[model samples]
Target: MQHIRALSAAKETRLTISVITFDLDNTLWDVEPPLIKAEYAQQQWLLQHRPGAVDAFDHEALLAFKTSVWRRHPALAHHVSDMRTQMLYELQIAGGYSEEESRSGAKEAFEAFLVERHKVVLYEDALDVLKRLAQRYILGALTNGNADIYKTDAAEYFEFAFSAESIGTSKPHPAMFKAALQKTGMTAKQIIHVGDDPDHDVQGARDIGMHTVWVNAQRKPWPSGNKPDREIVNLRQLPEAINHIADAR
Candidate 1:
């Protein structure tokens, strides 16, 4: 809370908020199913194409290998797509494939994963609240992941979207929040960033002077001791919660 400032009201707070930034992954939809399905698809591709990839690399082994890769290359942490691609590419190379074959297979394999990755099933109330909020405020998406709005058919709601890859930094980093401010031509005080993550969304935005709403869709407790301006059990409550925040200012 040391980084947080008093939420002074802007003139625009009398009407609509200057902007509303959203977290993509767990906030709007469940991310795990598509990701799991995508990974399974990738393994299937490997088994069908490669000789011994299935036996040599089962689910447990592949997960461990990915973890080790991420730990080894801290620089690529911001760009998960690149990390996944590079990991598969290197694994194929290690499996005796030529550089061209490995590169092609890796690229193809990632694209296969991406198809299911973007097949996100939004929460029952996510779209409703987003549409309601979008009518009154500027909407932007800020995420640490690489889910494309066009792929998810979410482009209509968001004025713009930024990810860790696009921002050249991840959430919980000052740079990501700074970039949002830069793009919107608004001060942090003028916007409210809503997300599920206590650290990345609440802490990061509040640290930079923005008001925050903790979308605790999971019913998790506030573990960090830093409180968000508002907390709601679901996005259905978001519109009312935001109104309360706006009125308080």
Candidate 2:
């Protein structure tokens, strides 16, 4: 294992953090803008190709349909991409298309959504912070969403990336963190997981004994009495937070 030694400020003893795992969406970038754009893109596809469906279903209706689809197929709940595609397929069928046509149309509409979805805007300084952090610690990503870092500019900095789609489960389930630990051959204490979500990211990693850094850009109060080991409002504060956690060890 590669270790970077730093003198603990509190204990004045050597400490090391070997790996840093991250949550992609809302952590590295603002996810809402692109998601809105992606939804628009999908709607545009429906308007052009499945006009009746577009006319019948508004945003709220589509959302309801998506929920129905999800409930119908509980086994694939973790697969967001698949769930979306399935919803599109149902929409196409409802639009008076044949089964074969609905299948192909759903696939194409999903492609449209994905193209826009991948066009995410990274938060300012996120790339620079990742670049700096990558130099010292082994960097990896664990995302609950279907966003693929490989398709984004952040791919180069990450040693490995896993999504709930690939792992068959999402964060807060130990499987994601355990997979990272297995992949990096590092113990929970030797890794730090950073993310924006209070439940999935902060509490999830902490549950498994890994250090956590909550990116509370919204300035929300800590939900529970048990708080994260470290907190920051932006990516620029990330390195220092990691150091602070390391120093305390």
Q: Judged by lDDT, which candidate is best?
A: 2
Model 2 weakest 10-residue run by lDDT: 5-14
lDDT of 2 by residue, 1-249 (tens): 233222123123224677899999999999999999998999899889888976787779867887898999887878899988888888888889999988998899999999999998889998899999888888899999978888888777888899999999988889999998788766788889999988999888999989999999899999885699999999999999999998888
Global local distance difference test of model 2: 0.86
Runs in model 1 lying further than 4 Å from the true structure: 1-16
Compose the digit string of candidate 1's lDDT tens values, residues 99-205. 99889889988888888889998888787788877766778889999887656656677877889998789989988888877776668877899999999999999
- In candidate 2, how many Å is residue 46 off? 1.3
lDDT of 1: 0.82
What's the lDDT for all of these models? 0.82, 0.86
